[model samples]
Target: MHIRRICESEGDAAGTLWDHMCRETGDGRPLTERARRDVSRMLAASAWHRDAFCLVAVHPGGRLAGFVNGRISTGDGLLPGLLGEIEALYVVPGDRGQGAGRALARAATDWLVAQGARTVRYLSCAGAHDDHRFWRSLGFEADMVCLSLYREP
Candidate 1:
């Protein structure tokens, strides 16, 4: 497998792969078709795409097996401080346990640090799972638990 940053020219492929990963992980409750289209649009919007860095792990046949997207932003407060956040990380089922996820995460974090970020963060769903250990192995510690109350739209 090969790991590298994704370029603007690869936006369509990246968006399609991201949509597939989201669908698989969300079971039957994945984003709506409109939302998926919106995601693709966002990927092509240039502004948002430029604000974040995307890392893709490719297979020998050139298929993307995993990816991570992150951004570094400063708070809007009076005294703004930089924060690095990983918005998504997904490894296709066939690529799990092959270190693709780790490589993508490492690349994403390193890119964030290069962009002048001081701290990195990612969100994992509630309840324990092997993924928790994966993040821990990457030197991430559980800092706080957040609860979200949502209403059906």
Candidate 2:
């Protein structure tokens, strides 16, 4: 798999992958139209932002196998210096374990480091054993756990 920065023309393809990620990891609800638009806007912004990026892993046949979006920002009051976050990462089911995910993550991390990030972090889905193991293998340790409560209107 070849990894590179995502191009402007590939926005739709990235959106499709984002939907797949949401479906696979989310609470079984499809993304609302507003949510989809919001993601599209975010992706567009990443492409133009110096401190943010989206990288895509392409199959030999020119298909996108996966993508990872990351950004650099000031850490919360507790942590000092700039922080790098792997905002989202998703690989097509068929492409899993073929190094696309790792390559994407590596590329993003490298970019973040180049941009002066002091530390890199990512949030994995709770109870996602495989996902946890994958990040751990990459030397990422659990720094914190986030809990949320949602109520239907």
Candidate that scores best on lDDT: 2
| C-alpha local distance difference test of each model | 0.76, 0.85
Give candidate 1 regions above 4 Å deviation.
26-30, 44-50, 76-80, 151-153
Which digits, one per residue and each the tens of the lDDT, describe model 2 over residues 46-133?
7677888999999888899999998898978467778999999999999997888899989999998889888999987788898899
Model 1 agreement with the true structure over 1-153: per-residue lDDT tens digits:
998776566667767777777776545346677877776565545334646777888888888787788777884533346778898888888889878889898888888888777778888887646768889999999997899999999
Off by over 4 Å in 2: 149-153
Worst 10 residues of 2 by lDDT: 25-34
TM-score, every prediction = 0.82, 0.89
- Residue pairs with backbone overlap in model 1: none
Candidate 1, backbone clash total? 0
